[model samples]
Target: MTTPLPIGSTIGILGGGQLGRMLSVAASRLGFRTVIFEPGADCPASHVAQAHIQASYEDAAALRRFAERVDVITYEFENIPTSALDILEALRPIHPNREALRISQDRLTEKTFLSNLGLTTAPFADIPDAAALDGALQTIGTPSILKTRRFGYDGKGQARLSSPREAAQAFSDMNGAPAILEGFVDFSLEVSIIAARSQDGQVSAYDPGENVHEGGILRTTTVPAKIPARLQTDAVLLAAKILNALEYVGVMGVELFVTPTALIVNEIAPRVHNSGHWTQNGCTVDQFEQHIRAVAGWPLGNGERHSDVTMANLIGDDMDRVPALAQDGACALHLYGKAEVKPGRKMGHVNRVTD
Candidate 1:
């Protein structure tokens, strides 16, 4: 896994979502091929990847066929099943490592890892049962969020608690799943640092991007975040610290709460992030390409921004504005080519660049 993947070697991607699609395109730019192994049919990545294996993760024979074709493996998402990963890991090297995925797959585990790293995080406690929920409510208190331990995203599988009385309904919403209670972070804004670590242990980070979310989904990411210079440096340093601690190879998105005091870790995504899409129009080596390079064991590329930019996600109905957006000279559109769009689904993104 130390040697760089030569030109035309195929990379196996574990998901066929938009992130995988974009990663496939990036790998092509570096003369490498990509194969997407996804359970769903007609996935976004399949449209661009050099090859596609449409089979369930539990299908050992299919997973073996996929592992045989690729030089290495990487994933677009963290919720990949452990059984599937165990099968793939024995065949090909998976970048960013299984430890990073293990920590990120659960809210309680991720929060604990960050706290153990000497990083600031919101007060959190594990909730394994209804009794645990009551205890966590007493310990973590009201005005907090109760989130499922795994498989939660875009504000789903979680609930906000204004008072302890709401704990019953919140715990019920989990349907007996493991959960975590997190004390609310009183922050001024949310920012994310998109970072990468090369196979050789070198690290690189992009400027922090201030994020705005609606309905628990990212709406826009504006770079040159409205944070003091010192906090921005702190954000990058903390992201690098996490990367180095994991011996991670590939890109990661570190979301943080910008408080009046120290920056608080909100969450970490061990892959190319929605916020970093601004790099598409603002930097020479965007996050996608940077990720492809790292996982391929090549030298990481420059991530310094050349222009201030704003990246806005095109949710379900947002696709209607494509015609008008396409005519706009300052913005560049990157559509996912999804066959159907449901409410809250990320259909595409547009990056508006400015000097």
Candidate 2:
């Protein structure tokens, strides 16, 4: 299918993180130009893009100029302000559409959407205020999680309540924002499926990646998850259903909880995802390229896996381990050109492919 915007046309991208960086690199390979709109002066994505509009998300004039220059737009992150999207969409097309963005931005809305679709998820309830928190606790129980409805990522803006005493403190710590209390599930492992939906509504999903997290941050993701083949097929079908429901057009990441009873939808990321980094070395068509194809209205590429892979995130001081990691013959080390290595920061990743 030919895109509304053709190859060699410029694409505007929101956010300048590592995901945007990879998207820009992929766009360049496909003969498309990328104009990155980011407020920061030296973001990782700006290094690769043809143009960088250095302005805040709320800057309407800058946004208008960016929209005028690019043919179509897409974002790397879901936390983009709604007002900013309003401004950009008035000028150019934004893929995955506003409903996808709206559903993905809030945990409560996301859970409700999944439930409405008959998808299993952790039991959850809304916490409107301090008074509501007690009721939520009673309903969802202790050993549960309390997360803000919006703008939480990388384990930030969330608290676990194992005891009644921790509940009020968790509420107070969040500055009394709207929140959700979710009952914890006993899962064998966490997994995620990354899939792409093209302009013609065709969907293709990569093999699910089994993930392990530490201190609220992703630690590693291994493909061809050591799970039953039928379960993996179920995961892919669920993800495709989600994308098709959203009428989504671009790459999306669906995190899942592989429980004893069923696979539950954990969360949805409406763009290229961290757990999918292994596809860089393991798939015939990587998630980044697939996103570029979908948003540009090009044909989706093959999403076949070539070899089993383990993708390890480089967090904070983990950068120091690069030399040793690079020495391994099977490891492909990818570093984000960020100068400082702060705790919990995702600097890069290493994909180790094995037979």
Candidate 3:
């Protein structure tokens, strides 16, 4: 087992976004400090982190200095450049490991990994080129989505093909990138399990949260998702199986498509997820704190929910509603402290809690 770092130790975080910002707060609550490494200036995370390293991921010198200062390293996102990992891994321990990052970085690799573990996923075929796209379409059929294998999130890097006629446009949308065609799933609802595993291999999962999306971005997450009792049990068990398979330490978000017949794995995020934001109001130890505890080599929390919560994201224009939302006594407002509010950008979120 890895020895736990002392309370005063510094934790290095890659990627400075809202997730990193929240993580910094959690670490501070536990008496640990955090330093953020991000390329962008005035990043949301930089507002709260003890220190911010403003450098590109490939900046070897910056990465070296970052690694030297922190006792342990973790990331808020999975799109970290491999070159950067080479520099950081040699200096400090990275939680959830490089193998987990590799698998989750690409959609094709993630699906293949899940299938090999006997887990169910949406039927998919890799599209290396135009020819492969045709072949995959012939097999997977129409009404499928062609998505870039890497660096996709919040509805980006994807094109929908309703039929064969739209194939050309969809493939052209890829912009010469490797892609994957996923067969459409007639799911009833989307739910995700926020699970965490400790260094010694103990795993715990929060109650699955039902998700609602708008234009590919997560809009809201309702805890105690409207799933059957047996399905909820299945969700937690499948999530545990995934953590055990990866031998992962730290938190993971496993998205699942709840069909009438079975649960299909949609994708897995190797860090705390947007869908888990509800945990902040509903659980004693929220996802952020759970992640900090796990990465710090501390024991996992119980993850028990004490109330129902509905977390809604304040997207671009949604910020206009913040004035009214802030006035509601039952709501808890958490803003990212971002200066600009572009369309589709997440500004903040509010959690409505009830017993």
The per-candidate count of clashes, in order, stands at 0, 0, 0
lDDT of 1 by residue, 1-355 (tens): 4788899899999999999999999999999999999999999999998889999988999999999999999999999899999999999999979999999999999999999999999999999889988988888898999999999888889899999999899999988899999999989999999999999998999999999999899999998899999999999899999999999999999999999999999999999999999999888999999999999999999889999999999999999999999999999999998999888899999998866
Tell me how far the alpha carbon of residue 53 in candidate 2 is from the true structure, in angstroms, after superposition. Answer: 0.6
Which residue pairs clash in candidate 2?
A: none
Reference-based lDDT, residue 200, model 3: 88
lDDT of 2 by residue, 42-130 (tens): 99999999999999988999999999999999999998898999999998999979999999999999999999998999999988898
Model 1 — TM-score against the truth?
Answer: 0.98
TM-score of each: 0.98, 0.98, 0.98
What's the distance in Å from true for residue 43, model 3? Answer: 1.2
- Per residue, candidate 3 scores C-alpha lDDT tens digits across 189-255 of 9999999999989899999999999889899999889999999999999999989999999999999
RMSD values for the candidates in order, in angstroms, are 1.0, 1.1, 0.9
What Cα-based lDDT does every candidate model obtain? 0.94, 0.92, 0.94
Better of 1 and 2 by lDDT: 1
Ranking by lDDT: 1, 3, 2
